[model samples]
Target chain A: MINFTILENYFPVINKDIIIGNYTFYIKLYQDKNGYFSLEVDISKKDTKEKHRFVQFLLGLGKDEPNELSCHDSEVPHFKIDYYQREEEAFSATIYFTFRNIAEEELIDYAKGTVVIITKMLRKYFENEDIDIANLSEVVYENSVISELLDYEEKVIDAFYICWKEGDLIVRQKGKDNFVIKTKHNLIKYLNFDYLKPIYLPLKEKIEINEKINSSSQIM
Target chain B: METELDKIQTTITIPLGLKNRIRKLKGSMTYKQYLSKLLRDRNKLAHNESYIEIQNLVRKSAVYSFGYYKVTFTYNEYNNSENFIFDIDIVEIRNKGALESIEKFKKNMLGSEKLQSYQELILTHKLYFELLEKAIQIEIEPLFSHKSRMDDYDAWKKEFESLGLSKKSFDFDVMRKLRTLENQGDAF
Candidate 1:
């Protein structure tokens, strides 16, 4: 592995993410506490809540495949970097790759291949997207708040819940509704938003918090 | 006499195709009710998604300030369920200096207008998180990974032995483990 400082100086400060198919590729580029620059990437599956099993299969954790010599021989070689699964969630698992201590020249080359491989594999296994490396390039240096809200919108889909002063709001999912907040606060009540009308802001327009405050009618 | 029937009595015309389409929709609700449901559902869907995002953030905790109050969420993300469980602490600015800052923050929020929007946003986020967390109780890699297809792990050694790859890769411990796995049929 070589070290690349130019790619490390700025951009992709951990919060840049792009959603492709049922997976969101979150890229975090940062300098560690000791000022060691590292690039980390994680692919989270939004559909399948699989974890270790997925990682084990991916890392070739334990196996003597028919022709492969070392377990690392099965993976890493083709992608040009070593990786393992980190941060396993119920419906998602983060495929983590650390591009630490890599030269700028080699890092760029390695990153391009990596992006290509990820695009190809996601298309191969999931077949839910027509995305390519170009789709990934835009994920660099996005506005954090919009990205956060957008990420929230993408992940949450349509499943919502509210707990303001108990019986304040509701989300409309079919079948039984489970809006129970465990706190013993007596004033809290759970109600569905379907019955309680509220605006769907994103479906209309994006809300920039700073802009909302600065340009609101009251401020005028 | 103005009766309930008078309130209900109204005539509206719809194209035959739309009327048929509405009739084909499978539910006991009337077309009017269903259309109204769709309209309301747009909002629910937006709120629900924000809600889901907050619940997902249970991987760690989140704190948001609304000037008058600040809500801190500490999540127990160790469970595998639809419900996300968390303890919430609402902190108020009681100190005189902090109270002034809170007032300044509230003023900057642009009084009622921004307050309403922020209120809806947080309410929606909290509502969705609560719903998804309602509960609660509670990989890997790569292109070359194509070769490591997990399904083969249970029996790959037998296949490898037959294929005559490299016995060196399968050490004594690994071989025994593989044999045990082979006999157990993935009991682990």
Candidate 2:
């Protein structure tokens, strides 16, 4: 089984254009041994109307074959969208897929293709005039900080995990930096890393130490 | 995205044996003229949206009629840093059924005939590599340099790094191994 999570913060609002609201976007994907894969997307509840519209747009697109390959419900497919209100707001959607004797390479290809399609849909939604295109790009480009860690020379690192804490998303760079960025309701309009933490070697060493301690405890 | 026209040019002398072969071929042209023609043909093909069609056209061009060649150069950048990379790859476009033809040709030829043809083809390889090396030096090298803005790299690197895990210890070897195994497909 494999699990992947993406967290985005600091959405942008421009020129009082379109709707003025704060938003958070989270997407999770999981694949199980039983040849089943699931995708979950969570957005702020305040943006429920827009989220619902986005969902409907996806459903419409899915119904229409945009590329050479299209997804249909009959083959290892099921999906659900859930909405909830917290102190802020959130929207959640999940997609499950059951594979049919497919090779791992095929599964990986499907996952990559699905990610591209979903991202394209979101980009279209955010860029549509009905939605704030400029602000959407700004928010996504600015607040989506995870790309930095991912692009690190593949020789240096492999993967990353993010955690939410104290209303802020804390980025623990697996072995290096642990940066805690304060959440903003508005789209991220400005980004300056002057005060951000630069936890590199020290955090990695600490993680190594902790692992050793945990293993020792298990033996004891 | 304005194409930079200023290029530093360099030339390397071709060996007499290869030059002699070029002289013997009908409709033969100088290396530079041949390359210029190839580039012109490639440009026309590239503008066409269909890659497969472009591939076909490229095979019919002078580059293929003569032989294969490779052109390599660093792209434009600032601060003396080579930021961009460019290559003008030219390869011989064989007839659609050339591979099968070559196999048949090899089968029909006796020992001495096969030896002579193989020896002659080596000269073609040498000329192709030489033309490729020189074209890149003259046409492509000048455009490459460091990007104008310092913040670009930092911001790009930051955004790039953010896309994956930051820790150095994460083991992606499994993912790579899985891909390799999948590619090998029961061979292992």
- Segments in model 2 whose C-alpha atoms lie over 4 Å from true places: A1-24, A31-36, A40-101, A134-220, B1-188
Over the stretch A1-220, how does candidate 1's per-residue lDDT look in tens digits?
3333344322343434455555555444443333333343444443345322222112101111223332222212121111222233322211111222233434344433333233233334333344564454344432332332233332111211122122222222223363423332311222112211121232122223434665886767
**Please, what is the TM-score per model?**
0.24, 0.20
Native-referenced DockQ of model 1: 0.02
Could you give candidate 2's per-residue lDDT for residues B70-112 as a string of tens digits?
A: 2221211111101111112232223333532333333333333
Query: For all the candidates, what are their Cα RMSDs to the real structure?
Result: 27.4, 25.8
Q: What is the C-alpha lDDT of each candidate?
A: 0.32, 0.29
Give residue A201's error in model 1 in angstroms.
45
Candidate 1: C-alpha RMSD to true structure equals 27.4
Clashes of 1: 28
Tell me chain A's TM-score in each of the predictions. Answer: 0.27, 0.31
Would you give me the overall lDDT of model 1? 0.32
Predicted candidate 2 versus true structure: per-residue lDDT over A1-220, tens digit per residue: 3222222221233111122254434343444445444443333213344422221111100111111111122233322222222112112221111222334443333333334333444555454425566554543343243343323212111110111111222222223443444433210211111111111232234445656887999999
